[model samples]
Target: MDSLNIEPTEFTPRINFDPENNLFEISGFSRPENVIGFFRPILKWLDEYSDSVLSRNIDFNKSLLTVNLRMTYFNSASSKFILDILLEFMKYHSRGNEILINWYYEEGDDEIQESGEEISDMLGYPFDFIPY
Candidate 1:
């Protein structure tokens, strides 16, 4: 599958999903004018990626997919979509794919940390929280 790389704007974040490298990263501030419009393509890309991986029966045990989420700030509208993105990765994890989800929050930022924790709890998945 081809990689999905979206440059970050002032209101949106940078999205780099490289299947070949087994690394995915989303970072920056997310408060786009049209949240749905901004996130729809990302969600679709993830769905397609999942389908591709499953169809090929790729062995992910040796090379785990690493997903890094480094968000400085995201509005409430964006938070739901962010949660949805994580849930998609959770699907891969549930299917016996080794997925390492790293949630990066700025040091001394309790709000971001708590948000990640809440999402982790909601999905019943533990995330590696790293304070940057």
Candidate 2:
């Protein structure tokens, strides 16, 4: 499947989901006007991918997934949706998948740091923080 790339917008975060190497990245500020609509296709795609993996007997758990999150800021509404996206990957973790989240934050960015920590705490797999 072709990757999804959404440009930076006043309300939406830039998205770069690459399936070739299973590397997905979402960065920039996010406070989308229509949160669910903005994320529906992405969530749908992941759902289909999961189904495909199971039906084809494709061990996607063996595939490496590197997720990069370098958001400068996000509203609380966006935060909830982002967690939904992350949970998709978390599902694979239970199936023996190798996934890593390289979460970067600005120095002294307490909000971002705390946000990352909360997700990391909730994640099924371990995630590392990379402060810049």
Candidate 3:
């Protein structure tokens, strides 16, 4: 599958999904005017990625996939999409792929950190919560 890269905008985060490197990252603000329009392609890319992994039956333990999410602020709508993105990754984890999700939040931002915690709990996945 091809890599998906999107530059960050004033109201949206940057996206860098490099399949060759097995790395995915999203960071910055997210309050898009059209949330679905902004995220639908990303979700589609994830679907294709999942399909590729499932088809190849590749072992992921050797090269763990890493998903980094660092957001300063996001609207309620964005939160739902973020959860959806994480849910896609949850699929890989469920299939025994070695995956790592690093949820970064500002040192004093309890809300963001808690949000990550809640998502992790909801998905039953472990995320490394880092404070910056």
Which candidate leads the pack in TM-score? 1
Better of 1 and 3 by lDDT: 1
- RMSD of each candidate? 1.5, 1.9, 1.6
For residues 16-132, could you state the per-residue lDDT of candidate 2 as single tens digits?
Answer: 988777888999999888988888888887787667752354654477778999999988888888899999888866666678889899999999998998888876456789999
Top-lDDT candidate index: 1
Tens-place lDDT digits, model 1, residues 55-94: 4775555457899999999999999999899888888877
lDDT of 3 by residue, 13-121 (tens): 9999998888999999999999999999999999998887554866545457899999999999999999999888777767777789999999999999999998899
- How far residue 79's Cα lies from its native spot in candidate 3, in Å, is 1.0
Candidate 1 to truth, TM: 0.93
Cα shift from native, residue 72, model 1 (Å):
0.2
For each candidate in turn, the TM-score is 0.93, 0.90, 0.92
Q: Which portions of model 1 miss their true places by more than 4 Å? A: 58-63
Where does model 2 exceed 4 Å of error?
Answer: 53-61
- In order, candidate lDDTs are 0.90, 0.83, 0.89
Candidates ranked by lDDT: 1, 3, 2
Query: Which is the winner by TM-score between candidate 2 and candidate 3?
Result: 3
